[model samples]
Target: MHRRDFLTFSGLGVAGLMLPHARLVAAEELLAPADVARQKLLADTVLAAAHKAGASYCDVRIGRYLNQAIVTREDRVENVVNSESAGVGIRVIVNGAWGFAAAHRTTPEGLATAVGNAVAIARANSKIQSRPVQLAPQKGVGEVSWRTPLKRNAMAVPVKDKVELLLSVNAAAINAGADFINSQLFLVNEQKYFASSDGSWIDQDVHRIWLPFTATAIDKASGKFRTRAGLSAPMGMGYEFLDADPSGRYELPGGVVGYGRSYDPVADAIAAAKQAREKIKAPSVKPGKYDLVLDPSNLFLTIHENVGHPLELDRVLGYEANYAGTSFATLDKRESGFRWGSDIVNFFADKTQPGSLGAVGYDDEGVKTKQWDLVRDGILVNYMATRDEVHLLGEDASHGCSYADSWSSVQFQRMANVSLAPGRAPLTPHEMVKDVENGIYILGRGSYSIDQQRYNAQFGGQLYYQIKDGKIAGMVEDAAYQIRTPEFWNACSAICDERDFRLGGSFFDGKGQPSQVSAVSHGAATTRFNGINIINTARSLG
Candidate 1:
């Protein structure tokens, strides 16, 4: 695809196709600390200024965001860029309406001007408001701090080492006979401080890492092309996350490698190269219903799209419609106790789970993070909510789902670490497969499409294997499964135990009118579903 084609994706607000539009700073410059005490003083000034400007409630966020990106193709480095940005955003509720303002300057005079603008905007918005803003009561927890435990900060890792790692990963693929390969690494750190008129002062240091690799194979004689992506999940960890654990490995039936908390990029690249070529000679899937075995790697994405997004209170309430359309999981369904999955299916939203993208001590709104159930015994239990939105849900507490990608963006409702609980009964993917008559085993994430309402969807996977008489037969290609949200979950037959549980996530989950990208993780064990519809993606009907 051309650069123009990639640019057509409008879901991201600040991104560069090849290089970002951020201020390029020296490596040492990234170490410059935006002191917490200085940020507190700025926050205090903004909070006071907003209150003095006739605001009933106010909260301010001071942020310093940093990113390091390295890209490589084949055997050479393509680009290595380091960028930094800092700013402040203020939110205020005045006369029953909400308004927000932000500024790059952190001076007292700049904050005063921004606060005045925010309050004035809120007052003007009140005239056309449907209802007065009502926030769930929250007692302030004075001063507190939290950090993502790290053995080595990813940003601190020498750029030379990072580049060498990428080059070696490329060599593994090319030497294995892959025609082409592209690899990239992304590191993020957010230094943030939050202060509210309610007397809460919170400071947090967050770190995240993602290493994405893809290898391509071309059968020039037959004019065929196939590609495979590495089975590495983006994580909320430090540079240590790249260290592969010898014991944490899964031996799939087709000789595919399944990774755990620790990863081996070079090993994955070698396997990915062989898999890409194998796909060139794979058989096309026959369109029909068959029992399905989904690895955690593949199941995580299924849970993310089918279960997570639909349960957001903002989407259910139609407050967010321009992005993915409103959800089919409405408020009335929650009141009626709608059945979401099978008797054994359990779904929940969490923000306190260690190493999860959404795991934070306190949300952008200053609410302490915790775990909550979204589904229990297959029934819809609750939806994710923020501080101001909690009152509408007939609840008195927030779910700590509020977040903003940048300091200049206003915080809003975002998805948490939505996950499927492991099965209570001891079950393994191997044992569960012995009970199946005919099935397809899938691995890795692929192209997917769902209705704007997040129902009636199609999902594909990176690899497919035919299961015959409770045994792995051969590989298949161009396979996609279709589902009506409710029916798919109700078909749940079995799930592996905690030992098989793993997490998969997206670095760019877009939501809202002026789209904002957020990081989120979804976890599940090897799961089985009975009698599902399948389609051959290679077939084109005129």
Candidate 2:
């Protein structure tokens, strides 16, 4: 039973078996457009005051965001929520130390007070520091504003309609033989404004949507069970994302070769559910060294854990020691010839890719975004850096990766839209699989673990299929792949062509002190790697 055949025979193709009934609720009622002018005024006033109040450097950031989430469990709708948040933060340098303060109020008086507090704090902190904080030089930038394009504003959709869509998906999952189904949909619209002492003013707006579906199958007679989960690739788009209905104006792409739009929640639900059923009866895998084929869905996590997190200059320099662990790959290793992967592996950290969740026109520090290499032909080339850190590294400029999860938090070096370049030659996913005589095809991401230093890691997946004699056998259960950083990328033998590449990401990527959640994207094509270690998760658990 090949992967495709398994999906087809398991009735995962059903359209709307468990579709939610809440799709009809009104969404616009929950959201009101925020005053962009007011936000801009708050930023400008705060920055001007900070500079006049004996501050050598100062910047102000304002943020407004709206989020709506819906979760469904089997036949019951578990959670439906809508929230709006807005705030402003001021950062100032007084006597050569950085200080920051924030307030939810954006009123003129409120912003003035925030700026005053920031300068006072900076003055206080400067007295205790041994050395003055120095920031890399940056040319002044004029005012700018950016907004992601979207067919429909997520807030315009009715809440009932959103719930109904989720319910419909749940129903379809149950119809596909799922003993239980858990589904969640998230939508966020964020607006940001920034003003700096360097004369840089920037405003940005982004809308994102994500759908996660999980299904569990149980052999009622034996109490045996398996679970499968699928997460949609997040995009800086809008409510049009949810328009993936087969019967509607949108149609899901067939043959899996082309990126297709799916308006049908039922289709996604059924597919997720069917995978769960097959996993329940699948044979447990045996641990060994084997060739592995990684789908884009699964490969994205590898890039995130290996390249994304580790390449953050802060993490590499131990600035993240209190939160996310530090990286073994340090600035010293970022020379031209350091081996980070195979010669065939080329990766980059780009903040300009269209539709990337991490894409931004300007960073929190008011620097323009740009593309740079993280791994060039498998060599360590670059680490994401902030304006302040660039000076420490003796670099002329920052890579524009600095970001803060919210207005209340200070900006720091964060992950970029890191991605692996696809092979120049065109190779279909099927063609790549045909070349593998004996291997395992892994799809989607699951549980994962990595050492504190990011030297060793293991990751599981939602679905695994055994390949024998150049064909997919059946599903496999309790499977995981493990590797050390250098050894893992060195084992890469081939990668699929660009046509098979896809983007995937997470919205709740945790980082920073006091804990903040940032969203980022990882893009990669289907790839085939040579001998790697595989584990039997069930046995390891026992």
Candidate 3:
């Protein structure tokens, strides 16, 4: 078979094998408006039943998802997928203990059974509890629904067009002499309808997209291998996101049109090839304390590990100790004027930022989302909290951090769009690098490790360049940095302007008891730090 034909057939083959049963499962009749109203009625019925059964509190979550993915490797289309899911979860507080149950079926009978099972579980668990669960006080909320703005629905796009785009990207890489190229694109559109006994009703529509690419090259002479990986940040966007130049203005996109220029993926491929070649030949780095300049891609991960996870009140209170370790930064310290960074540093956790991966109109707990501080002027200020943990932190109400990655999972406090506040004055990344007389400029995230307490941590990066006499010398290898959390932030000397900031994130950040994967974004500007411990990975191996 021709390469292109084989690629097309491969995708079809996989679809043929897996889709028939999946389609059957997803073919439930769409809920009519009256049916939706009845579902709400059923939810109220279940909540009332639980309360009458001696339950303290109860809530229900109904979720539906439409997911599609396409992948291509060099000349071969490796995978094509389309799937749908719908489910409901019932949660209850019985005698101060929590219990939960979920069912894929959305019938009134199914929901009633799930709620009954939850109450039973909670009653059983209450026997071993020490104190009655006390949720922070909150006023009753009324019905509301929100949908993110989209120029075109992702599902409306033809599958063939998406496949063609993937193939084109793969071909571009192959033309640059990449021995192997792999690319994957995923789109998910989720709809959730939530109802609570407090008169709160919420409907939310959220869309997400992910694009990841990997390329590998081999040297026949030395038998050495090198690879490059690039993963795009997931955005709350739609099919318009896939358009190269939706406005027809820019040679690339957004702007820069009318300027004598051309849009070509080959240019990107050439740059990647050159970078891969240089990285393989770069020399190992020397270990010592040195000033450092961090690009946004590298610094964002630092923020996620240090500021994001540590500031979660649940993690600080040891609620997450069984799985992910708890934070040394506690609630008391957060408000006690603890210094978290240099005087210029400030950070906020926001769920309303435009295009942010974590942006949500309402949390899984049915609470309206809002923005708040995690750090201000170097002082540790706030911890991400939900309604249940708000009282522990002496807060009035939740900051709306609750989240559940799947319909079956229980809602847990999750990270928000944690972001560093940009410098008041404009400072470009180039200027920051120029200010560093002798330092290393780190770009892209790499291997990372942090202690159980989240105090000491080490990070490596995809690319590192040595700086000397206020100029980037060349690419360097075997470079890594280690520092205590407080010490690391204290050393922050400057942060670049807002224009220098970029969003970076991971699709599979793991947390919770049953283990759930959540996608979160961290926005950061290029930053500089002083006197950090650097290591030579090549020498350390010996």
Most lDDT-accurate candidate: 1
Compared with the true structure, what per-residue lDDT tens digits does model 2 show for residues 220-272?
A: 99998888775457776777766764432211111121122333456766777
The segments of candidate 1 whose C-alpha lies over 4 angstroms from its true place after superposition are 1-14, 17-21
Residue-wise C-alpha lDDT for candidate 1, range 304-404, written one tens digit per residue: 88899999989899887876788999999989999998998999899987787777899999999999999999999899999889888889988999999
Error of 3 at 432 (Å): 1.2
lDDT of each: 0.86, 0.77, 0.73
Models sorted by lDDT, best on top:
1, 2, 3
Per-residue lDDT tens digits for candidate 3, residues 71-168, read 77787777676766667878899888998988777676877788889999999989998987777766657777777777877666777877887788
Checking candidate 3 for backbone clashes, the offending pairs are none
| TM-scores vs. true structure, each candidate | 0.96, 0.91, 0.88
Model 2 root mean square deviation, Cα atoms: 6.6
- TM for candidate 3 is 0.88
Best-fitting candidate, measured by TM-score?
1
Which rank order by TM-score, best down to worst? 1, 2, 3
